[model samples]
Target: MGNTDIFLDKYKQLENCAINEFKLPPDGSAVAKLEKRSEFKDIKYELNYCREVRNLLQHNQKLDDEFPVEPSNKMIELLDTVIDRIKNPVRCIDVAILDRNLIWRSYEDRVLPTIKLMNEKNISHIPILKDRRVVGDFSDNCVFPFLLGDDNCHIDENTRFKDLKQYLDLEAHPSEVFKFIPADSKLSYAEKLYEEARNRHERIGLVFLTANGRSDERILGILTAWLIIGQ
Candidate 1:
């Protein structure tokens, strides 16, 4: 996971370079200089993965949504191959999650304004808090039916919508709300959770909550499958 961060940083930097600067010949001296500065070898797996996807797409090959390759293996092999020649240690690569400045809302508040925020952020999910504790989540699945009147028309500016609080109850669906925990958690456990979600074909969002179940547990940072694969 450590190399994943370095890989992503290098990938993004190279992406910016490619977009903003003119391309040099793949084997030219200037290309060597560019490679030296950015250290593309640290992110070879990601590049190869992208190349594979591009090849598949360009050739009209059908690629499944599923990921068949193993992430931990690819990262390890890449690091081992370049260990002596590289300046950095591959084992030092770390996983840092993206932050979602969560907006806490009471179930009593009108749904329109809350749903509006969800739409504006382009996030499929939002956490609902009651008395400082997470009570439930407000997501596309939860909001859509109500908006379309297929479930119930409980969304007006003046309507007090606590009646639908059952949808957000924590006990209702514990797995739907991902609790961020320590990275030290066994890779097998993490992989199991990810695999179960993938097999079931659900959108996976797991938060790597910082250590200790303290005040920080209220919110940490978000993790997605693509982010884990160092994409």
Candidate 2:
């Protein structure tokens, strides 16, 4: 068909995809519903423009048996992108730092070397695992208690993470908390978690992606505030 026909076809596909993806009422305004979702924030303006174009093509009278406006290639591409995004949303693991590339330590691992590495790499948190499962996390906050507890207690070459077991526990440090999300969780869900944490005046240091969002599950990847918010 012509450009107008092609554009209308694609736009209708987009509307159907949005309706099915979001479970919206079939008779409702699909574009308007999509605008309200945080996942569609990036393309809100484009959606609005496309909606206006659709209105013009459907409501305005045509002259000489031709529509006044036709969608460009770029518009068609944008519609394709939005439809694809709605069909297959970006998952948390898709953007997380995968486990193989993560800098982590075991409970029996030396703490001094890890601390030096953290300093060199500017790493704020490191998962403390045992048998490939996260037992706790180590961070600057985990070391503060030791420093302030007793003048004699200090970190040394032979110090192991096991020595700071109490401090490394998930609930031991309240300043920064760790959360576990399923590996297949959508990025929007992760964002919502961070937003809720912010609303509660809490800080989420790391979001570990696991099979079923449980600490007992194997860690597949990790998410940080900078990684999620910066995106």
Candidate 3:
């Protein structure tokens, strides 16, 4: 019934937060499992410290001289951060951070200087759309590789996106290299999709955020690997 109680209560709150975030039962194992999640990786060590303190306090009848009777300011901050993160995950568009800088390619527009733009701006992927709705992605990987292949397909600024389709193999097609996620989705969901793509040996060059994670939804933003992996 003192500072130790307050600290213990704080840790208990964090456990509950993790439970809700993971949709698991309120138990030590659930919180432990959440500690290993990528979204929570930034806070893993901090959560570890809080867990240790909570464990010591719960198992002891009295405060030990070895432990700080009152949780430090840093500990309190850690608790607050973990709770906030678990309760409110940062959305895909929020982390995309390049919302204003998003480059676009209209499916009907003639082929662009994709490599030149990518080099000048250091961009890895650009979203291609059909009348404001995301249709697919255009990445430097597909561009350079296609150019290296047979030159039978005449590609120039006058070339249209549909024209380039014939030159690109199915594996290297722009349409096959992107995924859609709702703007409101947690970045974690996007990460899982990327992992799934990797398991299938397909590279997801871009993750386009839209109204409802649909290809036909108006493009709201685009997420590159750099942004998704944390930037």
Candidate 4:
């Protein structure tokens, strides 16, 4: 067949992939549904344009026994890209900093050195792990409470994460919060969570990807706004 036939075939594959991947209603407009997904936000216009082209190709009358319009190579390439994205959706774990590469500290680890490292690296948050599981997190927000809790509270060579235990709890930070998501969670879902938090005037300090999206589970990876923004 011609390029028109190939375009139609690819478009059909995209629709099917999207329907099965996103569980979109078979009777509804796939492009419309995809528009609502964060993953498709960047290509919304292209998707709509492709749909319009498909409609024209199928319904518009042919002239001189030839199709009225032909899809461009770029358009076909876009369809292929969209199809690939649908079949291999980016997961939160794909962008997250894996535990092995994560910059973290244990409760017994010296706090001063960790803080120094954070300063040098411009890291805003540090997870405190115990038994290979997240017990709490330390950040600039934790500093205020820890220091004001007592007149003698101070950070020195002897200071350890255990000393800031109370302030390090996930709930201890009033201005920011953390979320646990399963390793296989779609990146779009994580983006939605962050957007929802922004709508509520709250901030998501970090997202931890675990085996089952539970705080008590072993941490597999971590997501930050910086990481998501990069994607």
Best by lDDT: 4
- TM-score to true structure, per model: 0.45, 0.93, 0.83, 0.94
Candidate 1 lands at a TM-score of 0.45
Q: TM-score-based ranking, best first?
A: 4, 2, 3, 1
RMSD of each: 16.0, 1.6, 3.3, 1.5
Off by over 4 Å in 1: 1-100, 144-152, 170-180, 183-192, 205-217, 225-231
Q: Clashes in model 2: which pairs?
A: none
Clashing pairs in 4: none
Candidate 2 residue-wise lDDT, 1-231, digit = tens: 887888888889988998887788887499888977888888899989988998899888898999999889888888889989988999999999999999999989999999889999999999998877999999988899867778787899999999899999999985988899899999999999998999999999899999999999889999998888666
Task: Report the C-alpha lDDT of model 4 over 67-161, residue by residue, as the tens digit.
Answer: 99989999999999999998888999998999999988998899988888999999999999988799999999999889988899999999988
Candidate 1 per-residue lDDT over residues 1-231, each given as its tens digit: 454444434433444454334355443233234343333545555556644433343345334843333234454454344432233322211343433454556778777777787778776665666555455666655555445555556567875447556655543443453644554443334445666776876545444444442424544444545545562
Q: Local distance difference test, per candidate?
A: 0.49, 0.89, 0.71, 0.91
**Which candidate do you rate higher for lDDT, 2 or 3?**
2
Q: Model 3: runs farther than 4 Å from truth? A: 63-69, 97-100, 107-112, 144-151, 160-162, 165-176
Q: Cα miss at 203, model 1 (Å)?
A: 3.7
Worst 10 residues of 1 by lDDT: 84-93
Winner by TM-score: 4
* Number of residue pairs clashing in candidate 2, backbone atoms closer than 3 angstroms, sequence gap of 3 or more or interchain: 0
lDDT of 4: 0.91
